[model samples]
Target: MRLTRRGLLIGAGAGGGLLLAFRLVPRHYAGALVAGEGERIFDSFIRLARNGDVSIAVPFCEMGQGVTTLAAQIVAVEMGADWKRVGVEPAPVSPVYGDAVLAARWAPLWMPLAPSLADSPEGTLARLHAEREPFQITAEGTALAAFEAPLREAAAAVRAVLSMAAADQWGVGWETLEARDHAIFNGRQRLGFARLTQMAARFDPPDPPVLRPEPAREKPGSFPDGARPAYPRLDLPAKVDGSFVFAGDVRLPDMVFAAIAHGPQGASVLSSYDKAAAADVKGLVGVVHARRWLAAAGTTWHAADKALKAMDPRFKAAGRIADSVALETRIDTGLRKGAGQRVAAEGDPDALLAKPSLSARYDVEPALHAPLETATCTARLEEGQLEIWLATQAPDLARRAAARAAGVRLRDTVVYPLHAGGSFDARLDVRVASQAAAIAKTLNRPVQLMWSRWQESLAGYPRTPVSAQLSAAMSPDKQRLLGWRTRMALPASAIEWGTRLLDETSAQAAQDAAHGKADPLACEGALPLYAIPEKAVDHVPLDLPLPTARMRGGALGYTAFMVESFVDECAHFAGAEPLSFRVAMLSGQPRLVACLQGVARLAMWGGGADASGQGIACQRMDLAAPEGLRSGFIAVVATARQEEGAIRVDRLSAYADIGRIVNVELARQQIEGGLLFGLAQAIGGSTAYAAGLPQSARLSQLGLPLLAHCPKVDVAFADSGEQPFDPGELGMVATAPAIANALFSATGVRLRRLPLLSEGF
Candidate 1:
């Protein structure tokens, strides 16, 4: 990957004498899929890969977050590359490559997720006024929230660079040329991005590339007011045709297949006994019962399965379980112990909650990613080194973690990340990969280990089991929010799974810290989507063993279900329609207000649906990020009831605010798919965890939204959309809450809990 000259100076390595030749710079990350990128270097290569084809590397594991497609779209848009040529691949997550690229890409308009550096009011003032924002500074908004001025400025900067280069080429004044509808023009003729790029490359790089002025505005691919033309996604065909190979799909000479299990889910295996079964099975290459061992076999995937079954390794749980109740008690105890930094202290929530106020508690059961292909890794031990293949969101994390497990040099290991069928945050390069590497090393042969469906479910990392408790104080008018308090139980680690809640030390501490407050996950967009000047938001994060990995919609979806539903409760209490109440609350958020208005107009808010029409919920969470994120959206689903009084979604219509939409078909699919996903979440994707074990294992028990249940889901685009807000994620956050809110009107019971069963609603 060659680096542009200007990029070279900015990415100078350790020493000055070392020019840090871009090729040697290792901008490309290496994985079992693509290994070589050392984090930061590989990211820069995305811009350089534009020649007739688009090529951009991603760092976030595709744990089904749709970051891969989103990242490629952002890069392709900026590079002036055609949708057909874009290449989306995963990058290594070098310790150096924190969440910066993602933040820079998706949330350019907003600030990064930084901690508060200011301990006092004075420091806060200085940070707010700093030229470059102070580090470790927590602001008074969303965890990753900020103004859109910077991203707009970046778009303007890019347009300016193109225009300046065009001016030099055409011998015209810089202001004489304006970038419009993806082309630059003066009067006579127009030059598209292809022409300007060629001219710009020929000219000496602007010591500081002529930047777009602050007042500069460039609508990359114009779409405003709920309309847009779809762009193309990077090489999605690679996966469709099997032209691309995944870790599980890897094949090699003398390579054996394997089906293995990790120490059950989160618990470690204290010991195992498989000697008898191993001896009885044919072609059983002995058994390795070490902390991590790979068992091998001869022919087919069936052979791998049979060998594992024959080995019959038995284990004992070495780790403890943490659940909701246990987590709460610990939090109460931890708060008394007084640990950790106080995240927020807002207008008297204590006094507010103590006063006459409505209070509600939300409980979320554990959810697994349940990807089509569970985390699979195949590895072959070569002469003194190892070669590996797998689908990973972060190959670098795989390399390092694998290197540690295999006891080899990082350079000797190669990882490949294949197209993901599904990843819901649990598949971020971790133990799954480590096991693959360890097995390859122990067997000293090319071995592939695919988690069995049972293993995949039982051992896979899961979405945290969260319990959100909220208390709200309303003014005499019942319009303005006087105050709010929230409490949340956090998963043990961002990646580690929490079997139960409040059963661990850290989980308890988190619960206690947030024992009473306005929880962000439960109260995010729901709070000020309208406007409340005197309201305060706070959270209690209970650290339990729940997996803190990425879900389709993490904080947004989980909390929105609670917050949005509560907003409706207040609206209904006021004897005003939900949409009208929200419109009244709109003060600081005009886009949000406008978005709500737009969705309501289409959904026919305030109208009755005898299963005919339903109100809508809207949020612009992705707007806080850079341009072209496929997340900012407005949803309005018309729900109708059958003779049985069951809600069947008739048709779902949405106006997405994704700045610049790429692959309109894919974007639509994301929304439609998200609708199905959310529908599934509302009606299907729920699981009950009792005594630390999941009750549902198969699709039959899990209740997925099949064709019979899902109705026509129609999604529309806002033509002026210049950003690429993520659709996969946005499809979910507002769904359950919206559906529940709609159901509340159709059926008098405000279903406070999820999995609206026959008895509950």
Candidate 2:
């Protein structure tokens, strides 16, 4: 009884209630499930029911990006349904809705030097699905590109079914009946969708669905004919009204809150706890123990927290914890271990670099997600079924991990993904869900497990630190770049977690690491965009003691910081204007050049430079178009000024070409928000560790950029017409590099490290 567009023909239940479910391909293993050629059955993505309500079972988690609204608008536009009567729920875990296209795209990006499977996107998707496993978690900005076509098709198929029904009732041609505003209108009369559903359910849909013609082109910001209305984000009203239910807001009958504590790093045993100390605490239920962690559930959060502090547990293998300096040393040592894998190489860089060449080394400290809401999950065992709820990036992964931890059958567990406070990549891991489920199963009651900011600070896997050594050789005349060589060290991080805990965020990285390869995502944008005769990039995967995962732009932000800064240095050495120098080298990549040119125009780059120096940087961001194509571009220019011996960003101008724009306003906001996030990181911040715990756990210690510190951000989108490309995560790609270049322009100091400080000035 899988939900499908065809299933809608089966009709609504008695009493005028309509429900249609979309099913993904069913599989015991992700890759094992494949669609046979000419197969009619498709994976379910959304369900529409009577009561003028449309329910979107979102395959991707919404981390405040307005995906729910955007996706729902697609269904509403295709179905001709009213936008005011729509709601969203997390899609159930299934292989049918797996991110095959996203996975396929990641494969080539991580192995850029490898031969592509085939020319066409469909061929590549088929090859990848047949060969490698498809990841199900959401990350890498694949939501819009992946679901748009399938969702539109699904909605269209349903619309066609209703049209056929309307045509039959009115004795008119099917083509003559049109769906609009939840009603079908023929030349003579109109039928509300509710009345037509009863008749539509009786007839079988055509074997091959007839889809509507694609909409005509319009301006970049315009929602072309038949495009989804850019209604204020569907999730925003509830959030603003305080009626939104985040993971922390979920409650159940007899629900008890729990606080968790860790023994040590890599600890997998709950030896024993101080039961006596916790027993005296009022409202304290008791301590629940799992293999690697312990939790205290109580009548109230305060009680649980108070009891948790009173207990102590031991572990078998205490993991190593290092201070910030020690952690840096560990990463540096691992980087020096080997040359690692060559991600991109062209010509002989070693030979060209034998001549005197400009060299620089760049390093970035580990940064935290540090969202307002900590990791939270609730689990309950009811009628032999395990129900889990949480605000997680990967619902399917969490479901699977919960089943394993709680000794429950995979099919018996249902996961409900709620709204997240924030989850750059911190929520990608499912250990929290596993912990909650274990406690719930042990107690035989509903358990709400939440981590304190301190606990999250210590345990949450943050962005891995990265260091790179880059050298560039110029021609004898110094007019052209001759060679480029970059050797970088980055931990495999979340990718090394193996198959038992596979997630979309690091699935490609894990696959690359398994075959002695560097995760392209970890080294993306490392190669120079400039037209250099000889170029090569090699990476060393550092297995750091701290758990590492992607944070925002991942490698793009860090790599661009180094590569673009180096471009500026080369420009300075060659006695050429920075913008002109980059423009000269970018002729090979016209699209990139165009984006850079747009940013230059917006920021007024090289316009006699302000007393407050301005810097420009550009890079290709990772965005998967709704058409399953992986192509997007972004460029940024940041201005900095000295204020009482401190460096302040005076202004930020970002230009992007995301193929096409979805919601013009949303795209701008995403770019602006990403810029601010990047600025927060660049302006002196680090998540340090000491004595086996996080030193900077609280907000104050993290040194997040205050609202007052943020500068005016101006954003511009290239007039790339109606074909929308990837939109989010593009703004931050070049932010740090541009700021660093601006710093270099302001002060003659070559700052090659992150946490950009004014000490150099």
Candidate 3:
């Protein structure tokens, strides 16, 4: 498959790591809750200061997930300046700067992971941040505030300080001076900020600077303000030209190459003794095995491999699994101890599932990030401190891990991110970085460790393999929903033991009892989404040992398939058109209903099912709790039957109501990319794993929708003109399900899985 989808404006931390341990960290984590230790360092973070330059002092690094772009977009939108007028760079950690408050926002909804913000009430932006609740921002969120807040604050402060200084010079009240664009005007003269910044910077620390807030908060116009231009991304020029700097692209003085050459046949670590064999490679540095990892050192990659081959005879495979089904059982059991975990219970789910119910099971296999680039992190000790140079997704996480590895304080480790080849959900994955940092520190030198393709594939964790089960009860009317019970599997990396939605202690028991049995992801859509009064959703999750992480796409894809397929099942029994039935059930769902109706209008839903193929799907992503950024999104796809048994996507359309849009074009692009990937997945999946490894190890084998496969896709945005919405991630939600629905018309198969492939009808 030739895929056409792209993600956020990350410097994607690293995508190639499964092959070479190149990185692309996930800037966006769907289900993982955010947690940070220690006291709040910064009362309020002012990471980016405007002086025609934008600097983001992030704890998280970009392995290649486009976080820099998101951060830049946020700051730029906050400042209400032209994207070109501002610049972006990472903020290094300091005693008074890192903000854990954002993690509250980061802690999650399902879009974030569920947090304890149930008691938190929404308030003004100031009060929201003043308290330690996570600060929320979408690319659009930052842009909206850019015009509304900070620029206004900065401007007023500048004006007030200039007015005070001018008053001292002129022997008048400070109010006597008025302000305009970048200028302080008094009855006698006017001074520009360029001229005043110098004077203001020199003011004594004791000088009380009375900053003024904009008088009319509801109004948008600032002094000499006009609307920001909505156009193509300013950074697109560099992206188009390949001049963009990514983490993998970063280079520092005296960087050495190292590969963590360890892992069993299918990704488990084995024993090895190749010290003598690797001794003769030119430019070859010595090899070391720490934590069972085989490290080959050299100036060039070729020399390292020679050394690695020399050491191969002494290797032994350990903890290897021969089959997917057997590993699947162990993983599912290990991931499901979360049932004992506490989550908000709207009703008694067990008592509800106690009645007779229809049920299904699902199992999602381990998938790789399979990015074009592999994992690569460069670490060096400089002046008694360690510095990291690479593309990392979660720079903050990497920084913390690096600090731990180096036995240094958080402030001592500096991680610089470069652009990334691509990122899925693992950009925030810090294991690869942590391993490299640990190795480098053990050697106490500057080393650029890059994972070989096999190491990248097997050594790193796979998208957490998931298992799910659902059972639901039908009411007498056959239309009303009675209850729902679901069981899922999770990996250790995703949830800490005893946390809500996570239970580590019972995972072993869960998997030990699950081998040779059905799994849940395979039946994700087992429950209907329609409103079922008194309905309760219960999940029994499994925990696994082979190290799993969220393959968000897999969860999403599987969930959609099960739900949609089940909806068809429900519809078939009800003897109603699926579209009409869905619409009827969603009567009061305004945003969703509107989006659904809009997509139908765009896709031209029909009189006959087989004549014109159509599919519909929607996603609702919660932004922040107090902010209340809940919004609905929907899309519909129109597919034409293959004329002569060839794969062809005739037309695709979508309807999205993300509340408000930041950059319309970027939003559209995001949605379009989502649709392409969604449709592709509905076809089968971007990559396939076997014996715990990705078959599509390189881009060549990876299936993607290229230009030839591009459909005539169009999108319509419904503003409802709402506030506090996350347009960034929601852009891609509607495309796949809608396309799958459309394809159902073409081929009577309700796609129950992803990557609707060529061979499959």
| CA lDDT of each prediction against the hidden true structure | 0.52, 0.71, 0.50
For 1-761, candidate 3 gives per-residue lDDT tens digits of 00001211111122211111001222222211111221111111222222322243333343332334544454444333345544444444322121222333333321222244432323333233322222222121222322223223333333454455656666777666665443457765765434543344333221222334322221111211123434334456787998876655656677667766754434345455747666667888667676456777788867877787777734443444334556566655654544423222345556666863566554554556655577778888766687887665445556777777777887677777655565555454555666667767776667877777666665544555555555566666766446655554444333421121111122223334332233323223334446654443334444334544444343454556555555554554555676777777676777877877787787776732664665556655443433444454655555645556545677777777766554555555656666765655544344444554555555445555567878887777775556634354454444555665666666776544444453355
Q: In model 2, which runs have C-alpha deviations exceeding 4 angstroms?
A: 1-43, 106-134, 215-230, 264-273, 312-319, 334-337, 497-500, 503-517, 607-611, 622-628, 758-761
For this target, which candidate reaches the highest lDDT against the unseen true structure?
A: 2
In the range 78-113, model 2's lDDT, one tens digit per residue, is 778877776776765655456655555554443345
Q: What TM-score quantifies how close candidate 2 is to the native fold?
A: 0.88
Candidate 1 lDDT over residue span 1-761, tens digit each? 13233332222232211112222233322211221222112223343222323345454445434445655554444433355655665543332223322323222113214323321222322223221221111111111222222222223344555677788878887657766555678897677765564444333333333433322122423533245445533345665776755557678888777777444333445365555665555656534445633354545657666767766665555454534455455545543342333233444556666764687766555566677777778777777686667776545556666777788887787676665666654465356667777777777777777777766766655555555556677888876666665554443232122111111222224333433432333334433344544444444444454334446676665777777777777777667777767767776655566666667666655553334347466665643232222246465555644337456766665666654554556566667676677766766555544344456756576766668877766566665444345566777777777777777666666676665552343
Off by over 4 Å in 3: 1-84, 94-102, 105-191, 201-232, 265-267, 313-322, 328-363, 442-444, 467-493, 496-529, 543-545, 552-557, 638-648, 684-693, 755-761
Query: 1 or 2, which is superior by TM-score?
Result: 2
For TM-score, the strongest prediction is 2
TM-score of 3: 0.74
Span of ten consecutive residues with least summed lDDT in model 1: 134-143
Task: Give candidates' CA RMSD values in order.
Answer: 7.9, 5.3, 10.4
